[model samples]
Target: MQQYDVYIERQKRKRQRLIRRLVLFSLITLIVLGSMAGYHLQQRAVYAEKVEEYEQLEDTLADLEHEELLLEEEIELLQNEDYILDIARTNYFFSKEGELIFKIPDESPSY
Candidate 1:
């Protein structure tokens, strides 16, 4: 009977040790999974921000390229003598010989 009691005690201790090891392993696994989830969330946020910034920069680049094209068009127009003369005539009231310019009032008359 004493040997049987000792064997039963040893079996109970083994079961307890197994339970402890399982609990420890579960806690460690939970900790590792939580950390990985947090890291993934952080990296996703960063990637989202970078993607938004890249889109904004792309829009800015497109705008600058459009502006550059407009400037090139203006440069080409300025190279033409007729376009320059037309601009000077409209803005500065410059006229060729034998041409008459009428000065019209643009403001509304207060009656």
Candidate 2:
């Protein structure tokens, strides 16, 4: 009878140990899964911000392309002889040869 009671006590202890080990394993798995979910959520937020930034860059590129077209048109106009003459007359104060020459004196220092 004494041996049987000792055997029963040992079996009960084994069962309790197994239950504790399973509970600990379950707790660890839950923690790992929760942390993974949080990490994925953070990555999604960062990815969304990058997408917005990319869209803004695309818009800026489109605006620059429009400005480039306008500049190209202006360049074509400047290639005309009359447009070149107009710029030289107003900006450089140019006149035809054999015309009257007037010299205006300036008090400011010339560099």
Candidate 3:
């Protein structure tokens, strides 16, 4: 009877230990999962910010590319002899040999 009682007591203690271990393991797993979830959320926010910045940079690059093309066209026009002559005549009021230039006054009343 004594030996049987001792065996029963040992089995109960073993069951208690196993339950405690399982509870501890579950708690640790929950903590680890929670930490990982937080980290993932933080990374997502950073990624979203980076994506927005990348989009802005891409838009700026596109605008700069368009401006560059316009400048290139202007440069080509400036390099042409006929375009230069036209620009000089209009801006500087230059005339060819024996050519006449008339200064027409504006009809609007001056303030």
Candidate 4:
């Protein structure tokens, strides 16, 4: 009966040790998983911000390209003597030697 009691006590100690080890392992696993989830969330937020910045830069590039095209067209038109003369004739009231200049009133008469 004494030997049987000793055997039972040993078995209880072994079971307790096994339970403690399992609990420790579970806690470690939970901590690692939680930290990994947090890191993933942080990285996703940074990626989203970078994507937004890239899209805005693309829009700015498109606008600048459009402005460059307009400037190029204006430069080409300025190189034409006929277009320059037309601008001068209309805005500066310049005329050829025998041409007549008329001043038409743009406002309606207040009757």
Cα deviation of 20, candidate 2, in Å: 1.5
List where candidate 4 sits over 4 angstroms from the true fold.
Answer: 98-100, 109-111
Q: Which stretches of candidate 1 lie over 4 Å from their true place?
A: 98-100
Clashes of 2: 0
List the candidate numbers ranked by TM-score, top first.
Answer: 1, 4, 3, 2
TM-score of each: 0.87, 0.69, 0.78, 0.79
What value does the lDDT take at residue 69 in candidate 3?
100
lDDT (10s digit) by residue, model 2, range 44-87 = 99999999999999999999999999999999998899999888
Against the true structure, candidate 3 reaches a TM-score of: 0.78
**Structure candidate 2, residue pairs in collision:** none
lDDT per model vs. reference: 0.99, 0.94, 0.98, 0.98
Provide the lDDT at 107 for model 3: 97
Q: 83-106, model 4: which lDDT tens digit per residue? A: 999999999999999999999887
lDDT leader: 1
lDDT of 4 at 85: 96
Worst 10 residues of 1 by lDDT: 102-111
lDDT of 1: 0.99
- Identify the superior model by TM-score, candidate 2 or candidate 4: 4
TM-score between candidate 4 and the true structure:
0.79
The TM-score of candidate 2 is: 0.69
How well is each residue in 14-91 modelled by candidate 1, as lDDT tens digits?
999999999999999999999999999999999999999999999999999999999999999999999999999999
